[model samples]
Target: MKSIVAVQFIAAVFFATAAHAEDLEFVLVNDSSSDLVEFNVSPASSGNWEGDLLDSGYLAPNYEVGVLIADGLQTCVYDIRGVFDDGSSVEDYSLDLCDLGEYTFLD
Candidate 1:
């Protein structure tokens, strides 16, 4: 009986961790007229951009992209940077990922 209880407790802990991790992910929407040529997610506490989350591809205009904060960081706040094809950029700082399910990049 003790073993069973221990297993269930571990399972619950695992699920909670998974849910917390999922909360750090959000969808990035491009609300501008130009394509999103660049994108990145950085920890708010780091003061340095981790790297481009969009990799080599471009997020087209009026499209939505999924983004996840840096791995293994116990942070809910982050900085988002989006660059458009028209040489314009938008930057947001200290945004809570759990509070923002969908972020719209506007002009």
Candidate 2:
């Protein structure tokens, strides 16, 4: 019957909700000589840079922070940029988020 089919579909949806895939996550480690004022991440194939992930905040020197790639992200390779305290910035492109679980800005 139609009602029976609807009930079965509802049940299947409820049961499948718990089988979601693990989200991509990464840690940004600061190894540079100065503190990080801003950190940004975007798809490597894109031409323009997006907004700052830090907004008005910062990542201190010798510290690190975790970033989660939100669900529905289409690309795996990402570009990252970190602005140092001395007004200098570093950019890394074509880094795969799934492959590199952790990234460090070298001195």
Candidate 3:
């Protein structure tokens, strides 16, 4: 039996993965059973969730995609939100993207 779960990882090994100082581009892995419908990334200090990074199609289970946080902000700390097809969502707070080369949403 499989259970839906959300896992967070932030290791020191990912510290130098970003291309540049301000670029927050990383690979998003959807390991959860449900399809990911929408993905949002916003500054940790802000109250509102930013635009959908997924844009159009949903990210199916076991699939992954590369996301570029083109906000152009110098800050690396941000909040992440992922909405699934089963009406369930996961939220991660104050993540330093510059140190995270990849993020996986587990099941």
User: Which is the winner by TM-score between candidate 1 and candidate 3?
Assistant: 3
lDDT by residue (tens digit), candidate 2, 78-101: 788889888999999999788887
Which candidate has the top score in TM-score? 3
TM-score of 2: 0.74
Consecutive 10-residue window with the lowest summed lDDT within model 3: 7-16
Clashes of 2: 0
Task: Identify the leading candidate in terms of lDDT.
Answer: 3
Off by over 4 Å in 3: 1-21
lDDT for position 22 in model 3: 59
The local lDDT score (0 to 100) that residue 26 gets in candidate 1 is 65
TM-score of 3: 0.78
Candidate 2 lDDT score relative to the true structure: 0.66
In angstroms, what RMSD does candidate 3 have relative to the true structure? 8.3
Clashing pairs in 1: none
TM-score of each: 0.74, 0.74, 0.78
